[model samples]
Target chain A: MSTNNEIEKLRESEERYRTMIEMACDAIFVVDAESGSVCEVNQSGLIMTGLAIEEIVGRPVWELFPEDERDRGRELFDTAVREERGRRTSMHFVRPDGGRVTLDVTTALMRLSGRKIVVQVCRDATERDEFERQQARLSQYYERLLDSLPVGLGIRAAINATPKIEFENQTLKRMFDTAACKGSGITWDACRADMDEQPRIAITDDGSYAEERRLANGQTFLYTISYVRDLLDQWCEVTIVQDFTRRRQLEDDLEQVNRTLEARVQERTRELEEKQTQLAQAEKMASLGSLVAGVAHEINTPLGALTSNNDLFIRAIVRLKKLLDTSEVTSDAAMKERFDRILDSIDEVTSVNKTAGERIKNIVNSLRSFARLDRSEKDRVDIRDGLESTLTLVSHELKNRVEVVRRYGDIPPINCFPNQINQVFMNLLVNASHAIKDKGVITIRTALEGGWVVVEISDTGSGIPKDVLPKIFDPGFTTKGSGVGTGLGLSIVHQIIQDHGGKILVTSKPGEGTTFRIELPAR
Target chain B: MTASSNTDAGRSGTIVIVDDEEMVLTSLRSFLTLETDYEVQSFLSAKEALQYIGANDIDVVMSDYLMPEMDGISFLAEVKKIRPEVPRIILTGYADKENAIKAINDVGLFQYIEKPWDNDDLLIILRNGMEKQRLMKKLQQKIEEINRAYGELEGLHKEIVKTFV
Candidate 1:
């Protein structure tokens, strides 16, 4: 019926079909359309159907099916032949090893030489279904996780311009007084009053949990807010609120305590300043009283001399008058000699009077200066007056023992407390005069440098001992022999100068002369 | 020239002592009148002394450094302008080094003396004050004499020119 070339073509096509069926991973079974016999079968199909090709060959593919299901398998195969297409269906097959394999069977019809063949592609779908069931269990587990989480979490549906509450976790329901504040979509405005003001969270597309929040129980919290945008870009705000209310309260209390402490410290400082001012005033008054006493002692000496000289002059004049009254033209040598002696005595009295009177006037001027201070308390005082006054006060000490040389310079009036400055100079001068037992020169000089007035007092005297030098400015410390000086002299001097913001430096050697350098700010 | 109309050195000049304290003024006046040849007056205030100075012939003016109304420095400076030849001196109690320097530099202070002063030292200062006063007067006389000679020479030259013409 067929030539060799045509037979060869048919055989070749059949061989290609056989190769495709045998090598397939899926279960492939070919059924004869007209005879309903099993024409071809793959290894998986034979293993899956619990029947070998020898038993199934030239027999209907429905033969291996159980008697009840043989009709169903035959109907499905007949439909594929009629439709010439395949569609998926779930089915159970008895395997060669006596196990059952659930499969998704797809039957396709192929036509060749007026005969229709059914090619069934069966897929082993049991493992895939089992995986799907496991995934469903995992989804239930996640739902349980979201329910039991300790932190207060919430989801809001922002379908409209104003977001509405869609879901609230258990923790959130507990934090707020759920009976009142929960259901009607509570927002920041509803809770941000004295009743409850909690920290608000931010909404962002990218998730970052903020460790800050506010609870509805009138307590602030620390937590984060995340904005979950949907496919429509409408943001659903998911906030994770945490409680840090106690920490905030602690910080507030600490700030309040710090402020109170600062206020107390400032008050104590003010009190200390006031005490310093009062102490300075008291020291000044004490020095003034001592100065008055010194001046009083000085005035008495000259007054005594003047009184004696006056008595001498009056007596001499009376004696000369008496002698003249007695002698009228007599050549009395004794009377003339007496008159000459009386005249000489009167001259001596006149000279002494002049001397003592000037001395008294000097002492008086010094007292006047020492007592007077500018009523304004501080003023531009002629610094020379202060120095001259100090010189006048201490001149007696220097009279014969020390030769005081004034190497004075021009200096303008400087703003200061004049009397206090004078007292400091008086102490230094007196000490210098005291340092010398015999004759030595005390040189006082002054200059202006760097907008400041400098005064230097140099003395040729037995200097302070090196061992006692550092103690010179200490209160109640003295280098002079006891009874000769008050140890407070240098201390008082040092304090007064320091109070006025002046500098005093003393340079000395045991046997060499001493020099005191003083610098005062100029007005 | 403060010489009495008859140019003589024997005429004693008046000396005024100005102090802020009443005790010092009274006591110093009494001592000076009783002991010295000069007519001495004491003023308790620099203002009063200034007022007295306008009409009086004062050769020497002594003032205190510190005072209530005005300090001795200002008063002495004012006195120097009014009567330039009168010698002025400042006496004070404190031996303030800077004040002494300012006093000497600002006002040519005749001398600076301290309290409890030596009697001989005071005498020497007073003598020096009187000597300065005398010297200033003599200088003024010499300056007047030189002026008079200069005027005479000018007159003689004019006369000689007229004769030559």
Candidate 2:
């Protein structure tokens, strides 16, 4: 009964081995080691070779290999049989129909029916090798693309209070070459400190952002940072840095140019306004000149007739008297009385006419000289003459209100436009006259001081106030009643003096007097 | 020249006046006739005055400036051409002073009197011009008489010399 049990056990073990060989996923086959022939093959082995069982059972294993691989295949089988060892190799096969197969093969020596045989196991490896090669190529391409980027790129992580620089591209490596910390192994804390502001990068947000920072070396950087989840699902910040100093400097220069251009435009506008004012003043003076010429021409004719008529009346009366003296008209007491009455009446008329004619003549002469109607050209002008003419023109206004004193010194004539200079004198003299209340003294003094002819007009009257004196020559500045002054008189005087390369100075004590001194170039 | 005598003082030489204004002409003629002892002739136009001067013996020619047909300066210049020895006077307005000065320098003007002139001054100036003109004519007559007498004496001397030789 024990012998029977042993036989059954051995039989059961052999059946289990057969079943295991048949069901193995790998192709298992038995080959004759000495002849390199296939002795038996499993169902999987037949399917792997694409062959029938009769064609594979006794076929030489070398026939299954390609021509070039048959020699190595035979040698591996022989080595496994003679050395009683197991061997493994990758074998290339050519099927009967010229199709190629690549297999991972293992040959082991086995005793079958008391003869040494080789058991071969093969697994198809073409798909796995192809997959592995594709993975290697993809990784190489990705590395090359990362190194060629323009902006410096870095991956950073700060976890559990330990900051790490996980990956830095080739651009980052080159950038760090010139940085304070000259390596790619940089911490998040170090990078944050290098930035101009705090909170260098945020990984909580999933979108991209940009920021600008200046370094200690005066270099400006614009960094664009984006959040990325790595393969381990750990969040990190990706930073892209660009130098933007040159662009910022260009913008600043453009702004400065705009400011300068605006200032120049304002200056040009002011200059044009000043020129326009000068043109208006010149036009006014020219019209005044023509008007004066017309008045002078009109008045002189009538004045001549009136003056001559007075002379004629006086001569006629005298002639009649001479006749009476010669006793040619038969004189008597009554006739003599009548002749005396007529002579006295004629004398009275002649005196009145003479006074009236002289006054008219003086007025006409003043108007003509004050206008300087025919003196447009710059010539040698006597400053004293200008002052005298201005005084004469305003004599009516100053007749009883002011006493005039003339203290004139010998001075050379100035080279100037007489008309404009006379206008200045007229403005000052009239202003002096108007300043007096009831009765005051006006002193006009002239002198030669260094290369200049100086005429000083001083008035003992209500003087200009200290607060008002400085603004006297500004356009539209006036202290007089609105209709009493156009306010352009002193400003024009000042402008005319400046145009002649001259100066006017005023000194005043309120309630005491005011003095205007004009200096003109003598040459 | 006729000296100023008591009897002929009111009836002396003739004075001609040319003026555009009738009032001025009448006044001037009346004044000259009454005050001075000169005969006066008046004309409204310078052309008429020229024609009258051409027909008559005139001692002085007075003309007003700014006339219609011809101004005083031009009229005086024309009168000087007609009678070189006659004195010319201009009655100018004050505005015509520049033209009057030019006339005096260019036309040998004896004098220029502004309008509404003094009667005494006009009479005196006219009397002087008339006296000067009369003296010049008399001097010419005397010179002619002397030349004629000398010619006669030369003819007698020549006859005597010829007979002696």
Candidate 3:
């Protein structure tokens, strides 16, 4: 009964071994260790080589491999048999259809039926090898792409606890001192030490964050960081840094240039405005001068004729008297009496004519001088002369309407353009006369004050309005009705005075009087 | 008139006055005739005056400046070309000193008189011009008489050379 039990146990053990081998995912085969011949193959082994059991069972193991791999296969088999343990290797096999199968093979010495035997279990490692190679190639491609970026790129994992740097390109490594930046906590320390100011970034639930930092080397950078998961599904951060120093400097320089250009343009505009005002004033003065010259020319001719005729009449009367004294006409009382009467009458008429003619001549002369037709040259002129000439020219307007008062002092002649100075006097006198309504006093006072010659023209007429006084010297500013005054008179006067290195001032009270004070340098 | 007529009529010299204005012309003519021993002739245009002067023995030529057709300086220059020995005077209403100096230097003007001139002053200028012309004529006549005498002497010497040598 014990012998029967032992036999049954042996049978059951054999069946279990057969079932395990047939259902295994790997291919299992047995070969003769000395001859390197295949003894038996399981179902999976036959399927792996795409062969029948008969075709593999009695074939040499070297025949399954290519000619090149036969020697290596024999060596593995010899080694396994000597050691009495299995040895693993990987090799390619050729099937009957001329296709290739890559196998993970193992060889061992087994004592089955008291014969030297070899067993091999081969798993199809082609798929797993292909997956590992693809992964390696993809990683290399991403490394090259990151290297090609203009900005520095780096990858880090677990920034808080036991921080680790997984990957870093050449640029990031170079910027952070390769050895120091290889890890996480050290990289943060390097970043802090390199920045001039504290980096500005706010960390929230991770997506992306940016920091602008200035380095101690006077270089600026913007760091853009993105949270990502690597192929292994581990959380990491990607940092993209861009240099911003040069661009910031360029922007600052542009702003400074814009400000300078704007200031220059405003200054040039002010100069142009001043020149335009001076041009308008010059035009007004030129036209007035021409008109005065024309009037003076017209009046001087007739006056010359009248004065000459009067002179002739006087000469004739003198001749008649001489004849009466030297000739025999003295014997005739009637003739003598007639000649004396004629002489007396001629004398009275000649006196009156001479006085009137001189007055007209003086006015005409004053107009001519005031016109200043040839005003290219300046002369040493008495200020009083200019004032008197201007007064004489405007005498017609001021005759009965205004009383003239003169307070002339002993002041030296000033070196000046007489025409311009005379123009100033004329404008002041005319303005004063116009201010008078019905018989008011116009006082012209001149004196030497310090290093200046001062002329004060005052009028007791309707004074300038308080609000209008400040702008009286401004071009085109006038309170007079349109077409009555050009409004450039006082402006021209002010310009002329300024051009001569002088000053003009006005003091006026409404309904009281107005005084124009002109100060000219004495020299 | 009486003073002028009392002087020797035959000795009185002739004068020419050129003026554009009729009144100025009449006044000058009357004044010259009444105040001086000169027979006066007047013309309204410079061309007429030049034509008359070309045919007359004028002692003094007085012309007004600023006239139509010709100015006083140019008229005087023309008279100088016709009778360079005649004295010229310019009368102008517009007494521009530059024009007067120009007339004096270029036309050899004897006088620049401003019009409506003083009668006595103008009379003095006219008298001086006539006196200079008279003195020049007298000197010229004396030179002619001497030339005549020398010609006669030359004729006599030639005759003697022909007869004795």
Q: Pick the candidate with the highest TM-score.
A: 3
lDDT of 1 by residue, A1-523 (tens): 5698899998999899888778787888778877778888888777676577787677887766656667877888888877778866777766667666677778888886777887777778888778877888886676668668877777777746666886777676675645445554444323444334444555445666564445455456655666788557887877665546677778778899999999999988865654464466556655664565455545643453454455446544655565666667225777677766867777777777767676766666675565442222667877788788778877778887788788778888888777667777887888888777688999999888888899999899888887878788776687667997657777767776787888888999877778888899885
What is candidate 3's lDDT per residue for A215-237, written digit by digit as tens?
65555667888878777887787
Model 2 Cα lDDT, one tens digit per residue, A110-132: 88768888898887778877887
Error of 2 at A275 (Å): 3.4
| lDDT score, candidate 2, position A341 | 88
lDDT tens readout by residue for model 2, B1-165: 112432454347888888777767766765555555677899989988889888889888988777778887888888998888899998764343444586689988898876446566776888789888889889989999999999999999999999999
Instruction: Tell me the TM-score of chain B in each candidate.
Output: 0.86, 0.89, 0.91
Report fnat in order of the candidates. Answer: 0.02, 0.17, 0.15
Sort all candidates by TM-score, best to worst: 3, 2, 1
Clashes of each: 29, 0, 0
Clash pairs detected, candidate 2: none
List clashing residue pairs in candidate 3. none
CA deviation > 4 Å runs, candidate 2: A1-268, A328-338, B1-165
Candidate 1 has a DockQ of 0.02
Per-chain TM-score of chain A in candidate 3 equals 0.57
DockQ of each: 0.02, 0.15, 0.25
lDDT, model 2, position A264: 92
